[model samples]
Target: MADTISTKQIIKPENLVHKKSAVMTDTTMHYCPGCGHGTTHQILAEVIEELGIQENTIGITPVGCSVFMYNYLNIDMQEAAHGRAPALATAIKRLMPDKYVFTYQGDGDLAAIGTAETIHSCNRGENILIIFINNGIYGMTGGQMAPTTIVGMKSSTTPYGRDVSLMGNPLKMTDIVATLPGTYYVTRQSVHKPGNVRKMKKAIHKAFEYQKKKKGTCFIEVVSNCPSGWRMTPVESNKWMEENMLPFYPLGDFKVPEE
Candidate 1:
């Protein structure tokens, strides 16, 4: 008779390299399979827990795919009106300066209706972090063309692909804000690959540190993929994003602190 080892023996604790952060609740995530939002939330929770700020952190998210972040992350959270996360975050930070306040926003929420809030808050050097997820389309609202949608990109609204003359050009919101005086750090990142995920986590950690210093606004744009919205499988969407989206919205630190 052949002896069989138990499953526990096959998987040992010593081999465990990763575990869910306690800062994340057990609530089931509603994000689509293979969506980058879940990964982003995990990294965020890990960072908050690592910094020992779970009890003091406050996150604000507006109407969009990111609106339900509070349900996933175990931290103080606020829901804002459509595209108003930045405004809400600004108010929260002002009232409670000691709290780690940040806004989680999607492309439509951050680059379109909330553009004014995003601009003014950064212009004033609001001591908060802004996590912008730019998937190039309005993922929650039926995959419509968003402000960050690249030219020649096709969405529900632009079935023939986006035309610069008809639809105007894509908004480089991250670059626009980086040039403003109030921004201390600005970067564009992605989470489709393991290396990119690590880079994003590092950027987020640094952003929170800067927020602790009350230096200025730290804007990080995560160029993610919308598999359902893009009418492609998760793998295809990632490939498309790398080939088309990244070229228009390159990933890297656009601006950094003087030091």
Candidate 2:
């Protein structure tokens, strides 16, 4: 008879392809299925663990599904008012110059209500990382049209689809910030696929590195999906994001400092 190996015998550190980061808390995430926030959080945890900066990192989360980030990431977290994450992050970074500060914010909070704070923070070139999640629609506050909502996108506020003539064009906040002198690095990425997830991780890790160099502000915009909010299945939402959102938001670096 052939010898059989126990499952435990097959499990080894070398054989482990992946494992949940200890930097991430064991608490289950509250993001909707297919939501990009969870994936972004996972990469954030992995980057923090890889850099060995778990204790030195501080996160600011404002109003949105992202506000629950503190529950998932095992790190110091601060809560901010709606659309005020950038402002909070600014203060924290200034007071704790040695600590790595970052803000996890949504499109509504970052682009719409907190536009002033977002712009000013990036403009000031604060030594912090600003992770912007643009799901198109307002996920936590019901399916409402947000500032980043692209043309013809349907939302509770735009059931017939967004009319550019009346609603105005979608704001390219990342592009806006990239032009600011204070921004050292600015890029837009997504986590809808395996490749994109890897790319986002790299971008985030790079941003962290730049922050350590005091390279002003580094911003990463994640074009994410909202399944429940969009009333679409996970698969359908990803496909929709690929076809629709990608064309409008388009993933790639919008800014980088000269070497």
Candidate 3:
């Protein structure tokens, strides 16, 4: 004979530490385990939920691994062309001034092909959020070297490590955007650990808040890990990112509006 557990004992809300955000869909994520995309999606969804703007939010996804952000975030989503998320976001926000618009783009999509759109959008002071994921390589199309790929970093395209003399220096898109006078808030964050996730959430929340104020462009660069693309186990990739990626792309705010 076995004893049955009581409903009260099983349903202890007080002991619950975390729960899935209602803004996320039921579809299982396709990202590799330990990929930061899932964590970023969760944080974004949680921010939308907390701000009670699920219905009024619009998200633009680029043609990278994060292109499926529409499938995960339970909000109105528009698929943008390759490296065109920022432009799409600019148009949507201008057309629907009352709606909250944001773009989710990977390094290749933002720092490389979309460089013009990114720079112009921020230069124009578009009131929208830009979530840039910089994992150093093109995570979706193939682990090709990206504009943000660090020199000496190995990739499918740069099998022998990136040569600065040949490939040019890694573009610091976040810093570049921050330099634009139209940008109101710009920050770089990561989400590999519990404490880091908390900080990322705060940065995301601030971006959204600034959006509501009709402030200039708000940009957030999430220095993420791409274990599958990097050809390393999840743990090893994170370790490498901390040791290698962090130095080039240091975390924290690069620009903020003065009170």
Candidate 4:
């Protein structure tokens, strides 16, 4: 007995849209709606493309929302343990001096578990660029309290607002990292508004440029919005960042090396 049958084709997920821009690749991002990580990823990719460093660039991703950054940015990337992106970046840059090395990390991954790694890497004057995303909570692990969680901001761990007496005040990582003598460039920018996004792109470009020139460490902290964790609509989250976060983490260039 012979039987003939036709199988229906499966449709791909709608979220898997191909990016027309050369900077972004054809891949689906796992970020929640209105998340800022996608915006930051695009800016970084655009900067890398504009500077023509994709071939020579190496990205170190940490264990956070950005852990899958390699899938978005069409470049060489290596995954590192939580908060160890900076340390891994240092080693990579040291081994391959000609390569453009950068680390993409979140607030919890950088300011908390990776605090020592971040500080020591900066102190060593490693030729690397650090893209620090300070969203104020541990986005990947159910929005728990992070080292940068502002006082009075409630998280999974700090259900009744962050208690300074128990949890301590938020750590200003940009200011702290800027104090290291080896750091060549340091800036804090936001991704909420279009104007600020443009400024952030410029800052990212400068950081990559410094790394390309082997000018030492360049650290950029992007004050991002976490709408889901903040329990607000995307629009409201942006407003919250402008109103509350900006005052505590003022946006500006902390340091720039002599030309």
Q: Where is the poorest 10-residue window by lDDT in model 1?
A: 1-10
User: 1-259 in candidate 4: lDDT tens per residue?
Assistant: 5475443322345544434348678898989889999889988887888888889999999999888888988999999987899888888888999999999999989999999999999988898999899999999888999989888988999999999999878899999989999899999998888898889989988888787777888999999999888888999999998898889999999997776
Candidate 2 lDDT by residue in tens digits, 1-259: 6599889988988899898898999899888877888888999999999999999999998898888889999999999999988898889999999999999999999999999999999999989999999999889989899989999999999999999889999999999999999999999999999999999999999999999999899999999999998899999999999999999888999997789
lDDT of 1 at 193: 99
Count of backbone clashes for each model? 0, 0, 0, 0
Instruction: Put down candidate 1 lDDT per residue, 135-230, tens digits, no spaces.
Output: 999999999999898999999999999999999999999999999999999999999999999999999999999998889999999999999999
Question: Which pairs clash inside model 1?
Answer: none
Per-candidate Cα lDDT values, in order, are: 0.93, 0.93, 0.92, 0.88
Which ranges in model 3 have alpha carbons more than 4 Å from their true place? 1-11
Ranking by TM-score: 2, 1, 3, 4
> Higher-lDDT candidate among 2 and 4?
2
The true-structure Cα RMSD of candidate 3 reads 3.1
Where in model 2 is the C-alpha error above 4 Å? Answer: 1-9
Compared with the true structure, the alpha-carbon lDDT of candidate 3 equals 0.92
Tens digits of per-residue lDDT for model 3, 173-237: 98988889999999999998889999999998888888999988999999999999999999999
RMSD of 2: 1.9
- How does each model score on TM-score? 0.96, 0.96, 0.95, 0.91
